[model samples]
Target: MAGLLQRVKSKMAIFAHRKARGMLDGEYGSVFRGRSLDFDDLRAYVPGDEVRDIDWKASARHGSPLIKRYVAVRRQTVLLVTDTGRNMAAEARSGEVKKDIAVLALGVLGYLAHRHGDLVGLVCGDSAATRSLPAKGGEAHLERLLKHVDSHANLEAAASRIQDQLHHVARNVKGRHLLFVVADEIAADAATGQLLRRLRAQHEILWLTVRDAELAPSRQAGTDPIARGDSFSVADSTFLAWQPATSAAVQAAYTKATAERDAARKAMLRGAGITEGEVAGSADVITGLFALLERHRRAG
Candidate 1:
């Protein structure tokens, strides 16, 4: 099989064509505002680069926008947090496996962190256990992190409780770092909200929610492919299928409930001052991350 980081780079190459080249790097770098006065060098400014970093005199002399690079006192650490559980083996909104989407999302961000000269680490597991890897540089280390997430997440894994991983990070990891979380559509609750707030206090966080598949199909979408086949729940033995003959009232109720639940999840993350993004499939991971990083930079 092709390496995961290589797939990430391939997606980036496609994204680079759509947007300006190196725009992802510029956007990713702009999020962390802390920088030392020790000047390293100057380079051409990309579209997403912060305006404050533009050297006016240098730009005038060089005849284009230029951004100043600084020699950092310490390298930043990016913690890739995710869930490895049966839930991830289920279908996504795009009719693809949630675990595949999660890997793409994680790989994209981790690759960006690697390109930024930052150390990348991973914290992923199910409710039964959580695991952590030390932060380190290099593409080989990043590939190992991605492979771990890809290999461990399956239908046979334990149930997902993303809070466990967050708690592990809160208790064991020290120092401020960038925590990038990719997980399923988690329900909102008081305990999880409290834990998120606590984690937010110690680290800058970015959340990517892998969109889950719809449980029921609406009457109008009766001819959809998903509606033709049966669906099984990973959380339990209960099986559900998209019924074309389902009542409009039931569809409306499900729509309303889903909207409310999503609102609550967004509010919970917002309350903790963390930026959140959503990806329905692997195809949109790059665009979704670009939007996520842009929003994070704006929030900061």
Candidate 2:
């Protein structure tokens, strides 16, 4: 476990570097959630109070300076929910399986949680079954959590159960925490949206979608047909068939449908107040994680 932690954290060393803001060192907010200060309330200004906390306008209205008080809640819970269905087991353009990419993303964030003194947990499984590690803080505990996620136990499910995992987390988790939902491209099923809405109302959610090159057929013009003897891909694999669209018009229609689907998915996610991070099949996990943290840092 120590060795695995060292290996994965080494890959993320760039992200964990000391910055002027010193977020990782806790001088400012930890990288997970922006600033660490949680606003408590306003009160009469007292001597020795930090000038930045004074609400000048409020003080003018009330004829006295007021200071904003913040209580520190240093520890946070970061729960990772990963989909382990067979689709994730398929090869990515990088030649690594989508599941492996998903695990890399998980490790990057899990280690970040540990760095920030946050409790990390895992909820990984597919349609068949699920396993969870209760949120705990520690290098050893985090390594264990990562190991559980890296296991094949959840990857053997016969079908995708992303929605099932979402539902489980929504029902089981309580209070404010960070939830990372890792899956292939967003299918945006009805239940998924509804469950996400409910979960967002409780926990802060970030969606990390792993995209294998094969997911987008239009981009695979240079790639071979689905298979030599097979016209249609296997039920669980990429659905693209070797045959081209019946006609130019049919191809155009398919393209339009695909575009519309992508647009709708983005719109739905926006409405849910959830920002998404996408990692290419072959992209470096550390680089992908830095991009996600930058976006999150700005937004938070």
Candidate 3:
């Protein structure tokens, strides 16, 4: 099989054509608020650039906003958190396997951390158990992390409970770290919200949600084969979709429920001060992440 990290690099190479590679790196770097006393240089202030970095005198003299850049004095750790339950083994909105998209997202971020000279670790598992890999450097270790996620998440795995993984981080992990979480659409709850707030206080967090498959037909006629046939829930094999269920009223109701659910999820994350992005498939992973990082940089 082709190496997973290599696939991530290939996708990034394709994306580099549209945008400078450094832009992605810069966006990722800006997520961390930590700065060094050593000055690097000054650059024109972007929308998401921290206002604290602005040099008032320099801006006045230059007649424009400019941010003071600094050389990073410490190597930061990025912990990739994900759900490896059977739910991830289901299909995404783009008809690709959700776990594949998850792996791609994780690999891209891991590679960026590798390039930035930061340690990369992983925390992923199903409801049965949560697992962690010690933070370390190197592409080989990252490759191993990706491989572990790809191989373990399958149809037979246990159900997903992202809260469990978050609890693990809250209880066991120490020190400030950048947490990049990738998982499916998680239902919002009081306990989950409280846990997120606690974690947000301790670590910088960015979220990527893998979109679930469309059960109702979109405007594009007959494009979704999965929707045309009977759909089964990955968690319990419960029937989710069928031809009769695609009636206009049913679609309308489904649409309403989906919207409300998404809104609640967004609200929960925003309340916890976490920036979120969504990807329907592997194709959108790079762009989705770029937007996510940019949002994180802009977020208060």
Candidate 4:
């Protein structure tokens, strides 16, 4: 147990290091720079154009008109709501868990938001709304938020009532802010859609569903029974077991169900005029977030 805990901690540290470096390097585009006010390029300074923007040297060299281009100014607030519910504890085929993946995703986003000088805030919800960290600026604020998230065992309880939490968040946050939700694919439902619509009316929302490879269809079959050692309780001294054939069938059904849920979730997001995506534990969350951020910047 101690060894596994250490490994998890080490993995988290490494992920954080890589993520922090990526944000610092600004490899994911310059959206974090907030829109620029100064002209970046100068085409031909058209007639009636602002004379102040004329590039005299370029005009002399080209023997034609030239104008200075300035950067646009765009600033936004980002809010991250992470569902630390019981379902997020499922273990992926590679031994990675959904809750761990959620933390990594949240950490990366927090780091990126802080680096970009955006106000960063977190709303963690489970069976009920647990913690609400109002959007704030500074690395210190992000650190505090991350620490609060890391200290809690979100999966210790039963499935989370995300819809209720969303309603609560909507009531408290009443502005145009970027909202990112991280959760397992299984928990998204009809209520989630309703809440999404209400929230989208006031904010830019993005949904990221984390999944495990074992949950996929291709790897759902095998001869051995799916079993794991008893850790939650000592009442049973033997490993829990289920026939591979049965397990495979069950997994297939789950996969189908999850797919349907994902489709529904996507449609709801689309209806809300929001963008969404899924990230597997085996995949790179950093890359996923970078793509989302770029898309959001372009849309802006």
Candidate 5:
């Protein structure tokens, strides 16, 4: 498992490096200037405009033209919050776990934001929160953030809640920023809804939902149960299983329950005014993420 994780990290680093380079080259609509703009485009001097911005040399060269110079704007910060709760460990089908997908998504976003000259921070939590890294800029900062995410191995306790931690995050972030959340689309309780509403008013919030295909379909039909002699590992130890469910009806019931859960989760996310991207295992995270960013950029 450790080796697999290392391989995933290496691949992600290469992808992020390439993506960040393209972004830094100033793609159309990319935020080159920060949120606070000191300067804008040069335009012909108007009668009411301030005289200090006029470019005398350009005006002389143009004979009758009046040129005004503008300064660049301040940049916006981006915060990425990832849930490392036990729920994230849930398997989807026979592929990568939700936790793995979340890590990759966060890594890409962190790199992209850093490349775009946005200060980036990470908040990891379940019921309680841990601030792994504060908002900072540059490639070195991004690399450090990725390393922290990679070294994170602890899982949240069962029944851990996210609402309180989210609220805390909202309060601690001093300025308006882009908040990207990676988690499962679990039902949003009242507290969760309130926290989201408060944060949305001040920041642009995007939700990346990691889900297992098996959880969506809810059934494993026609698969033979493991025999008594078969061994499997739970936690860090191997153990033999005496029996496993093999009934088709049982699988069908599980499937129905999972479908209902997924529906409810989607509805809840919509109500919270958050757009969700569902990811299963290592399925094309970059494509979905890029599409979302493009949509947001267009809208802004």
Candidate 6:
């Protein structure tokens, strides 16, 4: 697994890319400017500490004034927030598993942050429970973060419970950071929109949706065959058996519905000042990421 991560890491040679500079606020450096604009830690006030850096509440708690120590402003934190629910277990049109895509994608982002000397963090889970790792830098820390998602984060669960996970991240992560969310396709809705907007207020959110042909039926033609082991559901109708062929009209209707659903989802993200892209299969993984980064660069 570590070897695979290293291969992906190598493909992310962002130094040649102009957008990498944008990650650090257009500075002429290769590193990402971290959450230094936000306070890092609180220590007992020092003689030369700035008065504005003093934490009054901490001072009361310790019976002496304490100073907030912010990490280097040039360093940034990259948090990978993912959902390992059942939907993630589905197979993508590229023939790679969604869970594998998620791991690789996470590896890509984590590797970029690692290369730039930025801290890497994670918040991943399903309906059962959500786990979080505070931002920390280094090869060892990045490896552990990747391993946890590869091993502990399961793919058999039901509800992704993304809203809950979002709230968890919001409450646990301190200050501003670079947040990447990898999850199933989100249907645009008020509740999720509100939560995303709130998170956007405090962090740079880059949305990644794991795409699979099975998830949204295209307008093409006959019913798409659900691979023997690949089954999915909509509402309460679970498709466990292989799918049968459908007329062109049926496929069109399905396509129309999916288009509308996708449009609404995009609209919601736009409203929240978020942009999303897809990671389809193993082959498309690296290319998709580079393309996504290009978009981020242009946006910045």
- Name the candidate that leads on TM-score: 3
Worst 10 residues of 6 by lDDT: 25-34
The reply for model 2, stretches above 4 Å from the true place, is 1-4, 13-42, 45-68, 153-155, 215-257
lDDT of 4 at 179: 78
Which residue pairs show collisions in model 5?
34-74, 34-75, 35-74, 35-75, 36-74, 37-73, 39-71, 92-212
Error of 2 at 178 (Å): 1.0
Each candidate structure's count of clashing pairs: 0, 0, 0, 8, 8, 2
Candidate 1 segments whose C-alpha is farther than 4 A from its true place: 15-18, 35-71, 216-228
TM-score (all chains, Cα) for each model:
0.82, 0.73, 0.83, 0.66, 0.66, 0.72
Q: In lDDT terms, how accurate is model 6?
A: 0.71
Error of 4 at 288 (Å): 1.1
lDDT of 3 by residue, 148-220 (tens): 9999899999999888999999999998888999999999998999999999998889999999998753333
Q: Quickly count the clashes in candidate 3.
A: 0
Candidate 2 lowest-lDDT run of ten: 20-29
Q: How well is each residue in 178-214 modelled by candidate 1, as lDDT tens digits?
A: 9999999999999999999999998889999999887
Candidate 3 local distance difference test against the native = 0.89
lDDT per prediction?
A: 0.87, 0.69, 0.89, 0.64, 0.62, 0.71
- Which sections of candidate 3 miss by over 4 Å? 33-72, 217-229
Q: lDDT, candidate 1, residue 281?
A: 88
Model 4 C-alpha lDDT versus the unseen true structure: 0.64
Q: Which ten residues in a row have the lowest lDDT in candidate 4?
A: 227-236
